[model samples]
Target: MIDLKTQYAGLQLKSPIIVGSSGLTRNPSKSKELEEAGAGAIVLKSLFEEQIEIQANQISDPNDYNPEAEEYLRLYMKQNHLQDYLDLIKRTKEVCTVPVIASINCYKSDAWTEFAAEMEKAGADALELNLFFLSTDLTHNGPLIRDLYIDVIKRVRQTIKIPFTVKMGRNVGNVTALAYQLQANGADGFVLFNRYFQPDINLKTIELIPGSIFSRPEELYDTLRWIAILSGKIPHVSIAGSTGVHNWEGVAKCLIMGASAVEMCSAIYQKGAGVITESLEGLSKWMEEQNFHNIAQFKGMLDASKLPNPTIYERHQFMKYYSNR
Candidate 1:
């Protein structure tokens, strides 16, 4: 039998198929379904810091006539039900047998540390901080943003002893430096590249339209490249590949590139929870065909340091191709 058991952020997972934070995980029934379907772990729907701050503002505002109140309410509606999230973890623990990870998106470092502690008390097997900052201010630089992340990690680490991972974006100047720093600061693992939802232009009305298109198969290429480059570079840091992982082949590719596990949001949104079983089956079939007994043998097989051409991952081929040709 193929051993699907693997380690994610020090948590022993039965499989590497993690149901990423999304609306599906927001529902208790759906979360239970995913657990029953053999998901390694479930990241509860993320509680957005922006949403919390907006709610706090609305609740404290004296004027009821503010037009933005409506927008605030709409944003508030998208927030995860913390009580429900906790109950799901408790109940899933009782019936289902897998790790239930709680996810939180924090804007301020100190403000959300208490909440992280609360999640630990709520019986979350681990916590995944969906740390994000849109550093648009000219006054703030990369070091400042990195410092914010460090502060947040430090605060959360102090409050909660549960093993925690961080889901980060690729906007940083030096990913390797940041990854190593986070590892040193007590982060158990890193989920590479949280795809931000960018607003699009509506030419007809000249309005900014909001929509996050589900990731396509091709989007996995970029994530694969980074995972391959940074896999074994960071000390005691596990890597999870997120975004554009729509199928089992993508999961296999991530493992080969040194990702400890794979997280999926768009695929479940498109294919439903049943996709979990399909993905695992596909992975098991591939392993059998390849004559591999376990995930360890194949994981990180194509990482940059192990590859014949390590520099290929570092240099951009687009400019090189045009200039040389």
Candidate 2:
């Protein structure tokens, strides 16, 4: 008998396969379909702060552009978007048997975070803050920018009673230190390395274009290295793998690196939701072959802290391999 059960951010997941937040999980029907297809949890489509702000900015009076009017418009837009998301949470919760995690994409600790409490009231099992800030300002220093992320988590923690996880970006001065600080500030869990939209240069047009929107399989290693370094280092904080998880093999790799669960979207987009069923079956067969009856038996077996030489994760250059070659 094989048991794939796992725990993430205090929620019991029958499997470690969570349908990540995207257009794939924007509707309740999609949520139900994924659950039926054997998904462990659903991270509902994120409520973007820019979505509200843009709508507010678009409204400018012909002759009189009032700051107060824009402020009121921003508030109204915020509430409208929040209500729609709350409705999604309530409806998805009603249809899906698995945990429903609400997501918010924000760059600052603004009033928008207060809506986290409202989402919990609407039946969201937990919250995942898709936190990212592209620091383009010349004056912005590393520590000052890091503080913004910390402040956002702290504010959200104060508002929501349910467990919340921070889905952070990989570009940081010291990821280990930031993870420790966020954990100290009350992050229940973390989804390693949020995938950002890459930009590509259009040679013919001499313009910038959006690169591939979906994560590729090769992107898994960046997240894997961090998971191996951070897992088991913190107390009571779960680590979730995100980005580049395309199949059961990818899923198993993350588990071995000490991830409690993995968030997948790009795979489902390319292969359909049936990939979930296939991955689960493949994982079970692999586990049986390895003589592992449960997830805990093999999970985190290769994390940096568990290995004899922890420096393996810290090594950046391929000098050793080049020398041997």
Candidate 3:
């Protein structure tokens, strides 16, 4: 049998295809189906900071804020939402054999950090912190923003013992510096590029609307490049690719380029859970053709530094190649 086994953030996953945090993952039934369909792990939908704050705000008004009423109402809503999440984790753990990863989209070090401990208590095998700020403040610099990310990971790390992964955005000016800082402070894994929400203008209605949530196949190259670059640099941190991995070929490319695992959402949304099974099984067959028995045999094989000419990964537009062709 071909060994598809891989490790992500200290947890052993049977495959490399992790279902990234999304609404679909919140359902224990869907989670179990993904597992049965050959998924490596499942990341439950993230509990956003905004999600908690909005619920709290709707129930209690700050202008007429009553300490007793606010406390009661806030706790009531938070508990209800949090209870559903925790229950999902517990129920999913019971139903599925694969690792159940809890997710949180936190922009700061605040009350939500406390929830990490509760997540651990609820039987989450790992925690993925999708940490990023809007950065609307003009005063922010690389170091300050980097420090905030480091602090967020550090605070949460203190709250729970389960291995944690930081899902970062592409805009972080110095990914190397940010990853190093988080690794130093106790991040066990880093998922390159969390897909953020984008806005679009409605030409007909003159209103701002949400952009396409699904990732295009072309977006895979940029993510693959970073994974290849960072894998060679930081071998200690378990690296997973996110946003743009859509098929088995994409999965194979990521693994060969140095990712231990890959997270997929848009593909799942469009293709259904069968994509996980097909991707994993197809990868195994391809590995067989390549005469490799395990993921370790080919993982990182295509790291830029491993290639004879490292410039292939760094070079962008080639007027030379275009002119020649």
TM-score attained by model 1: 0.89
Clashes found in each candidate (C-alpha, N, C closer than 3 A): 0, 0, 0
Candidate 1 lDDT trough over 10 residues, lowest sum: 74-83
Q: Could you say which candidate leads in lDDT?
A: 2
Could you give the candidate ranking by lDDT, starting with the highest? Answer: 2, 3, 1
List candidate 2 segments past 4 Å from native. 60-73
lDDT of 1 by residue, 137-161 (tens): 9999989988988888878888899
Pick by lDDT: 2 or 3, better one: 2
- Quote each prediction's TM-score: 0.89, 0.95, 0.94
lDDT of each: 0.83, 0.88, 0.88
**Residue-level lDDT for 258 in candidate 2:** 93
Report the Cα lDDT for residue 310, model 1.
Answer: 74
Off by over 4 Å in 1: 60-85, 316-325
lDDT tens digits, residues 103-141, model 2? Answer: 999876886567898999999999999887878789999
* Candidate 3 clash pair list: none
Ten contiguous residues with the weakest lDDT in model 2: 315-324
